[model samples]
Target: MGTNVTVSLKALLLAGLVVIALAVAYLVGDSRGTPAEAASGGGETGSSAKRSVTVGGTGEVTAVPDQLGFSLEVRIIRPDLQDSLDESGAAMDRVLAELADHGVTEKDVRTTGLSTEPIYDRSRNAPTTLRGYRVVQRAQVLVPKLEDGGAAIAAAVRSGGTAVRVDGIALSVADPEALLAEAREAAVDEARAKAEEYAAAGGQELGEVLTLREVSPTYAGEESWSEASLSRSYASDMALPIQAGEQELAVQVEVVWRLAD
Candidate 1:
């Protein structure tokens, strides 16, 4: 009887201790909360924790073009392929010499095209008869000084005679590093201004910039003069009249800012 009573008492004490330990564990867990709750800042929502605004701005810089590009071609046809090639080559040589004398460097003159093709007769009575051979030589010249572009072109045409064809003339900015930097600064300033305005409208303070990215820039007024237009505008004896007009470079940027309370 006595041994059974002692065994019962020991079992009751062990069960009581386990219940007290479980109650303590429950109290501690309730105070600390779950891992998910802690990660969510104890009840803060995602939207309230992170607030931001994105804006885009554009900036443009204009300056006169300082460089000129010329696309020149020399074409000739003859009864023999060798004769056609020789004539085309000689005309191109004379044009290149004239360009060099007019301050164009050797490196700036590049041969872009050289071809010899057989001319075909398309008469209804004959079946694609070979009439003659046509040879073409083309070069691109870069004139550093925009003012000398007309003189250089005229000299080349005079030396190459009627065989020389002025395909195109393009004007561009030779060095745009400083211009690009200034444009970028202006773009960022515009973006920040927009962000601040938006923040004020939303009744929030503008915080630090979270992200910034530059989009592809836009260039305006880089016109290419066509061959037909050139011929119509200028006479054979006169130098080609070129105007170095203003060109604009634009930069666009996207900025993201975190909104503060």
Candidate 2:
């Protein structure tokens, strides 16, 4: 009887150990499978959440220019460098005096360029020889009043004589910051409107902006007068036919929006 009882007690202890081992194995398998199940669920959620659209839009505004800008150059040639420089300087002084007389202030006149170089005489059967020195000086003038540009050019030419050359002319607004701001606002509005359209077409409601970026603004239809067109002879009393046409300023933007129910 004593032996049988001892054997039964040993059997019960072995059964308890086997049950504990099985429980540990089941717990380990469950812990490992939970992460895989959660990852699969997360991937499905992420795929469904990534619903968005991107669009681009542009805006433009036009306005007339308020100011005129041009450059004038005086060039002279002489056998001596000093004489060439002196002649060019005197011519520039006369041109400045003329511009001042025509209501252009000293602050508006700026010396943009100056250069002196040797004139080489290259001819057949003749070795390269230095003929004389040439001196060139250029000034950029800004006329506040649009009507004064032609008169100023004519005066400069008369004072500087045949050596004077009108380089180029351009029309511009005095202040462009306000115009740029307006264009930016318009661009954003256009982008939002386009995004909404896209969302509606896709049977989704526009939720929130995911991202926004601005493309560099562009300007079109700005008038630039060519040198050849304005170089023709003009009388002192006659005004050069200058027409300040409209200038178009344009801005563009890119935006991304998320879609919702």
Candidate 3:
């Protein structure tokens, strides 16, 4: 009887010690976990405390255009669709040949549009009657030599006669990659200077760049001259003169800079 009683007492003591150990472990874990959670929250707050400013700047560069682009069309109106097509096709052939004679290669000329539509006679009382069919063949020509543009246009008109129509001519740079790079560099420099000005005004200094994004570049000073007036003048046996103006390439960028005390 005495041995069994002693064994029961030892078992109760062991169980109590186990329960106390578990409680102590849980308390220690909870104490450490609370501070960890607080530290994580404090980190988030610190991140939010960072200061930054955003600014935009623009830069522009102007250069003379080296390339000229123009559109020409040969149109014909006839009672028969086949006749209209034949006439327009012959006229276009002559126009292309004339352009070739003036140093405009076949690759430089591209057919932009070809369509046939019915012309309506609006003089009818009740319903409009079909007058004829009109066929138009349009092409765009790129003149690498700006000086040859006038002669190129004049040649096309002479080849196609009154049926040839010059839409318009625009001047632009053949390769704008270098110009764009210069504009971008200028834009970044302007942005940095503005950022510094602002930081100094606000009693802060500029730190590292937080973000940088370039806005899509834009082109200005692209002058397009209509050939309608010039065509009339050409009919009077006057010389056709073409003037290529300068083109302005502009670039803008938005930058975000961190501020330091």
TM-scores, in order shown? 0.76, 0.74, 0.76
lDDT for model 2, please.
0.80
C-alpha lDDT of candidate 3 relative to the true structure: 0.84
Task: For model 1, give the 10-residue run with minimal summed lDDT.
Answer: 39-48
The number of the candidate with the highest lDDT is 1
lDDT of 1 by residue, 158-199 (tens): 787678888667888889878988899999999999999999
Please give, for residues 75-147, the per-residue lDDT of candidate 2 as tens digits: 9999999999999999999998988876788898888889999999999998999999999998898878777
- Model 3: residue 185 alpha-carbon error in angstroms: 0.7
TM-score of 3: 0.76
Q: Please tell me which model should have the higher TM-score, number 1 or number 2.
A: 1
Q: What digit string (tens of lDDT, one per residue) describes model 3 on residues 1-261?
A: 999999999999999999999999999876665554555443233434457789998988998887778888889999989999999999999988988876799899999999999998886566788888999999999988888777777778877888888876788888998999999999999999999999999898999999999999988654555667667656764435777777899999999998887
- What lDDT does the true structure give each of the candidates? 0.84, 0.80, 0.84
Q: Which candidate, 2 or 3, would have the higher TM-score against the true structure?
A: 3
Q: Locate the minimum summed-lDDT window of 10 residues in model 3.
A: 40-49
Stretches of model 2 off by over 4 angstroms after superposition: 1-48, 224-231, 235-237
